[model samples]
Target chain A: MRKTKTALLIAASTTMPALLLSACGQTPTQGAASPSSGVVTITWYAGPITGTGVRSTLISKFEKSHPNIRVKLISAPTSTNTDRANLTAEISGGASTPDVFNGDVIWPAQFGHAHLALDLSHHLPKSFFNRFAPGLAAGASYKGQEYGAPLFMDAGFLYYRKDLLAKAHLPVPKTWSQLYQDSRILQQKKLVRYGYVWEGNSYEGLTCDWMEFMTDAGGKIFSNASLTHSVIDSAASLKALTFMRKLITSGVSPSSVTTFEEPQAMAVFDAGNSAFLRNWDYAWSNSNDPKVSKVVGKVGVAPLPTFSQSQYPGYSNIGGWDIYVNPHSQHISQDLTFIRWMTGTQAQTILATKYSEIPTNYAVQKNPAVRRVNPVLNIVSKVRLVPRPSGTPSYPKISQAIYTNINSALTGSISPTAALKKAQTQIDRAVSSNSL
Target chain B: MGTPNPLEPELTNHASRPEKKSPGIRRRLARQGWAFALPALTIIAAITIFPILYSIIVSLNHITFTSQGYHFHWVGLHNYSVIFSNPLYRYSLFFTVIYTVVTVFIELVAGLLIALVLDKLIAGRGLMLAVLLLPWSLITVISAEMWNYIYNGVYGVLNALLIGIGILHTPVVWLGRPLIAIVSMMFADIWKTTPFVAIILLAGLQMIPHELYEAAEIDGANGSARFWRITFPLLRPTIALSVLFRVLQAFGIFDLPFVLTQGGPGHATESLALLGWQVMFQDLNMGRGAAIAASTTLIVLFASLLVLRAFRAQVGEEDLG
Candidate 1:
């Protein structure tokens, strides 16, 4: 009796584990079509466009139009790098719930090379790509295939306190030197605590800010268009970097700007503390919003100022999001439909007018009605746009090299010359795939 | 032997007879135990062992993701060589080690002092313990974010307080300079983890027999003498355990620095885990990332072993006792 009981217990326990293991292997039936209703559900992963339910609004609008499909919203992390990591793990691991995801505009080359994003050119009509503003469609392509559809456009703009500028009897500065002199006057007159605040933190945003200054001084990250060689240690870069450092030493800009990101810089400008803020298009609405801005009506937006040697408006680094389909997604057609609708006139108009996003749709971009709603949209065509050296998949590392070394110089940890030389060496290593 | 008893069969149940059945019973019990543990063991293998083994293999190969799946090209130690030769990786290694050593040392010392004081407290001990656990209980990311506000350069609370009290003539950018940023990050880490170390040491302190201290006191030993002779010697195993735990955790520091500075003002505060994450996810260099992870694991493993070996004699003696 005892022996039989032991045998029975052993059999039951062994089978229990097998049952558990088998149960663990099964995945949930997400993104699956309902057998009875014939309705399909797809997940869309996106970061916060606006805290005011923009995603849910868009989803409801889409679902109303296309009743056959249901869209589930998955809120992604606000940090772009964290979002990329999560998406990379999910797509690379073959999880297919997120049929579509919103990625950074700079991710096309890297995502395309890794096969993380599906080639939309293979699936969508060629005419679909033409709806985006000029240069946006090309920006969303890697090699010969388009991987993402540009959803919105963003560019750097110079935001100044009109009240402060007026108080100091200064016109809107058109050149870097002019802006510097004006800022000094504002600070010296006790009209403003600080002159300028921009993103200088050692992150992706710094790379964007660096590109503007570098290009304004005729400094190119890469000597050749193919991005095979880096000439970041040129004399032009030294001049640009030196001016940035002098801004701190001369007390025109706060020493703490070295730690500033978009929010911090924006906060300083919005609080009526700083005289100038270099930020993206969204700052126009943010600065004008009375709920958050002390200088609501006192702020004015203009194109970023260039160095004396360059033209009036300096380059604005292209910044925005792009929508892409996951290669592992089960609902490819539905994903494409969502992408098309998002970039369509109706949705683009909502984004532009309500949230003040610069629409990537060329029709909406050129619409006088939409441009009037968001003043930054009107100035976008005037400012020169420069693309980050993201033509290659190694752009992330290259950007890191630029931002970290440049940040060191900005912090006075190293000289501008040393920082540029180090950036050059690291960028070379990244291009050659020689370093981590 | 004198008489052949009726209970002779039971009485003669010698080693041979019982031992013969015991082996079969023991084997059956062992099998049953294993059957019951199989599910948990399988989960562990899947989650922990498999990833570790796969990460090591990945480190040895050039890995790329395609639509079909992952494609691996064997590259021997090329990835390791790349990271090892890189200055950034070298700096990260140096920074992580120094960070771990400094923070752990400070935490241990501070923890011991707190633990000693707590052990002697007569009132509100429970409340004190709960309060001390608060920092440790809060998530590292959340606490790090709080630290970010305190250390903000433009309008930080710390600056406001300092200026109000007239300690600082001007506000300092706490995370703007390399040295200051590293120190600030370490301070935040110490603030969060010291309480954990204290709690562990307190448990160890409680475990020591009160009579030992009493006996030492009766023998004319001073308070410091009592601690040095009785308290320190008996707390060796617990100290070893806490140190090992702290070293392992501190070496893999990520969330604090990641939130506080993102390994800036120029990668000055970058930890090994941060570097590995950046290389793997941000840069999409899987092989190099895996190499960094594998190397970190090996270093941690080696460090832990050394820590254990140093206290092996005391630990073994305690185990035997």
Candidate 2:
């Protein structure tokens, strides 16, 4: 009995280490095989698409064209965890199983730096760079090198209720003062709950909207490759912030706007309760969806209003996603091939015309098919893409400083001048500390 | 429970027989303990302890997400200094403390009340206990979403009820104002966590002997007097344990406020955990984020120690031992 017990203990001890080692080593492998012999599985992480069913249609087409290459589509979370967990796991584990990653435009730099993305300049023609809007090319570039191709482009535009404008006897607001006036008239007339709805919550979306106002007011957050100390605190930025404050405080915008994000603001506008909404191109399709939206036919798209006369055209913050190959991917050649095919003119057209994703390719943007699907393409052609301040390493820190101060100002926690002054101090400290 | 006789002949023979074989037996037992613990220990080390140590190392470095790859420079204490100097970080710290104190206090009081009510051996007591524990069993993420709808400005049941009762003419934006947003989040937390505390206390209530209460009644004690003299004293240890667990859980709160407010209505709801998440993911400042996370862990540890000390004081050292 004693001998048997001793043998059992020794055997258990020996097997334990083996079990642990096996558990640690069991990472999922990418299903990569020759196209002829086995199905070439390509995983794609995409954004939430509503109405048009563009993503599903595109997947079916891609699979049909290359019958051997099976496309596995996964939806990325709208929240933060999906981005953090998926990207971190892929980079840390050196796994390239997800052949195509739907990267945020702001993230290319971060991912590229982590050595998790493949440089697409090698696979595609150099002229591919020329096909996007001027500043859009920068969205996919890091340190003067192209890491990925722009999949889609989004520029902020003013979507308004045409019926409300007509009822209030107002034309589209040409300037900040005109916007405020129109909103006031509409509110007084009981045409809507407020004059406008916008994303005012302290987030990346808020920064995008604030940039449009700051740039249109002729105030820049940074200059000469470094944050311009006290420049964003200038008269122009204060003017823009003051106008925004007046609109909110004067009852032209509801208190709920303070908590609204992209979808929340869009939902209000689509419900026909708001006169104006400042959002991306994606809102166009949702607003035009006859089943869900009340003001489908009455929606109008125009450039965001301007404040300074010198700023000829109003600014629109560039927002969109791109596709990049993971550098650590074992199948680099295959990933590049996939990226090339996805961003090609043919695919871009299909994505734009079918899915409502504003194609990055200039040729696709001007394609007659795109115009037929969405008449707003003409306006998208004219709009310029404004790059985020976070294009540099110090951007996140800089953006936080700006948004924190702006949020304080908007919430009446601090005076605009005081907020701007404090913001300048914070920006200077961060930039100098980071050696930007 | 009887102690082994040291002078027994079998024990003496076993001790006197080669000491070398005894060492082997002891070694074998130690090895068995290790073998049983190794799998769990290895997993814990890899998933928890390793990341914590790695984060400390990363926090001391200047890391950026750029095109080339994670280029890092050793910049000791720089990230920590930034967090210390920033006013936003100060604001987040203040809000986290307020949230922790408010939520924990409310949950404790409400939990104690519910536990007292459920302590009576009423009809269908088992069913009532299960129903009381249902909220605790539900996943936090789902509850957060449900509460978000309740707090919604348009077509929310909360606002609808308030209006129906003629409380206000217009719908109040529960999550739109700064101060109100924090209060709203606290209410949600109190609703979800009070049940957990009740369950813990309920188990403690079951263990208390009925003889003690009977003796207290014979001593001419009233219900309130009996509760103070007999019940409260005995329940002190269980209450302390429950509060300690709650304080730790509340300190590290993320999902409730995150889902409901997204730290919004202008940074009013930004807790340490949410701020840490933003730094790590949104800003991609892993170094600074890790530093914040490390600091948070230390702060929570200190707070828990204080609570534990208070708990020991109430229960006395002998009972704890």
Candidate 3:
């Protein structure tokens, strides 16, 4: 009996910690509303969109428009990956709050496949989907079912220093080579400390940057609509990656660009260190803000440059958040109403004019008043847009393969050829669902 | 009552009452002890054991989620095979192992040196220890963000200091190159955790009697000789304990890399924990992710067992001596 007890004690102690090793991925379920209250409260989990008051303002306005439905805002982490992880854990474990969430535009396919999101296409009318700008609705769908409502639209744009270009007596660069030459000339004249900066970090942002460069060089990630195969190891992709590496080696961009995400790249440009920046629509307002920027009036917005002058405006990777509803939400009808109002004219106009977010509503996007509010909005129609290979539910893994390999090449740890080959291998494995 | 109790003699002597030796009384006392501890044990079992078993079960299945709930299809050992064949998983395992080995070894050595210095310190020792623990006191995610700024190539404090002293003409990207980025991450980890190791060693140092040093000095033993012969041998158990803790913590490192690098400059700094998180949450491949998690747990368990065995052997030797 003593021996048995001792053995049991030893086993429990040793294995106790081992058992603690696995994650207890339980999300706190929201308390349900009492039936007698007659007013419904829905939780909206949103990350910081542009500014501090955007969510609150939208919530207050939304509450005024619909008196019966009250919205509770649960601010999410700023890191997109962290936000995605939290939402996934919560919804997968069957927590019933966060009726609506603001998620990355690329998450629809993965979330839809997992059944974490409510199919908006089924609940909403066909005419409701038609109100969004063309391609926005399609981008928010997977397998012909829409899981998200496009809240706003965003695409990459070139933000350059008007002062630096004027000092070098150069016009706006029409092609990638022209931009490179202009950057070199400006750096040689000591007009700017660095020539160019963009998101080269190993994350989803890098995939977006890679998409722009690869598409400009006439390369495609998937050769077919099915996205079952990867064609990353191609000549056009090599040209794109090679040029990206050259920017670092030739001192046109700081070697640190390999570690840069959007914020860091933008900070360098706004601090008067770099001649050009590649970022989203919000960069226009950010660069023009006197408090956070040194180049307030000197920044000029333009469409991203192409590889050749003939394809003058390069492809800008489509990026923006979408509104998704929790499948486990208690108030599905209220969630639908919140999504509809958030995507409607009043909210879209406020987002476009006040926050400088690119509106997904076609009417607000084409509104002359909204166009006059920011220079980024004026050039939105001219830039070519390319979506990341997010059609497959394996998109997150596919993007990881793209960014990690491309970043390795950019950091000079591996050659562009080797990186592309590795990426191709990984992407193939991802699509096949045969490897982790 | 049918079996003899190995610890009965010690229990009876401690109790110092002849009647307490009765099997009924001892068994009742044991029952009461268990009754008092049951609540905490239940909580621990619920939180830890249940999830661990669930996670192991998850590893053996292909899972899908619908509006209704999860759908599990068992595919025994398939998930494990997938992770084994995946190059990313292999790389992450390799990286986590190397990182743990390098960081833990260096921390042990550095911590020993700091503890020794502080042990001999005559003035302001309390103040010094408090200051030493400042880095340890800071939340890891917050400190990682701080390190991010310090390692920033364009405007980093490290770059500015190096350039100001004319060490180089231009800044080096500390987190850009794969090799350097790994080194940078390791340095950040060592900087934050060395104090914890040092404190543990310091407590162990204090527990050594002063008479041992006196006895050694009278025998004409030098500083190095005394350290090896007296201080080191007596401190073997403490050293083993610290190593066990450090090894377990280091092997599962996540927050530092997740915040500072996000396993970047090309997956150079990706730890096993980070990779598991990416596979589980980001990819939503629950089966493969649980397999990664289960495998990580087994590796950690194996490493800690080796540590505990070494500790037990040292204790056995001490008893013989």
lDDT of 1 by residue, A1-436 (tens): 3322332233222211112221222233345656367788889999888554888989999999999889999999888898987777667766676899999999999999999999999999999998999999999999989999998889999999888888777899998889899998988898889999999899999999999999989999998878988999999999999999988888777888898989999999999889999999888888888999998899899999989735888889999999999988887888889999999999999999988999999999999999888888889999899999887899999999999999999999999999999999989999896879
Deviation in angstroms for A58 in model 2?
A: 1.9
lDDT of 2 by residue, B1-321 (tens): 022222235325655555556777878877999999999879766755555556667678877544434567899998888887777678888888888888888888888888888898688878987887787888988998898889877657899999999997877778877788888889888888899998888888876778777776888889998777766776776887787777667777777877887677656787877777776655556677767776666676667656656655444433222
lDDT of each: 0.85, 0.72, 0.87
lDDT of 1 by residue, B170-246 (tens): 88999999999999999999999999999999999997778777776888999888787778877777888788878
Residues forming the 10-long window of minimal summed lDDT in candidate 2 chain B: B1-10
Which order, best to worst by DockQ? 3, 1, 2
Q: Model 3: per-residue lDDT, tens digit, A131-241?
A: 999899999999999999999889999999998898878999989989999999999988889999999999999999999999999999999999988999999999999
Ten contiguous residues minimizing lDDT sum, candidate 3 chain B = B1-10
lDDT of 3 by residue, B1-321 (tens): 122223335435644664548898888988999999999889867765666778889899998877777789999999999899877889999999899899999999999999999999999999999999999999999999999999999999999999999997899999988889899999999999999999999998997778778877998999998888777876777887788778778887888889888999888888888888888888888888888877887787777767667667555544333
RMSD of each: 7.9, 7.4, 4.3
Residue B270 local lDDT, model 3 = 85
Whichever of 2 and 3 has more lDDT, that candidate is 3
Best-to-worst lDDT order:
3, 1, 2
Top model number, TM-score? 3
For model 2, the stretches where C-alpha displacement exceeds 4 angstroms are: A1-39, A50-52, A80-85, A227-230, A308-313, A434-436, B1-38, B60-82, B313-321
Q: For each candidate, what's the DockQ?
A: 0.31, 0.21, 0.46
How big is the positional error of residue A424 in model 2, measured in Å on the Cα after superposition?
2.7
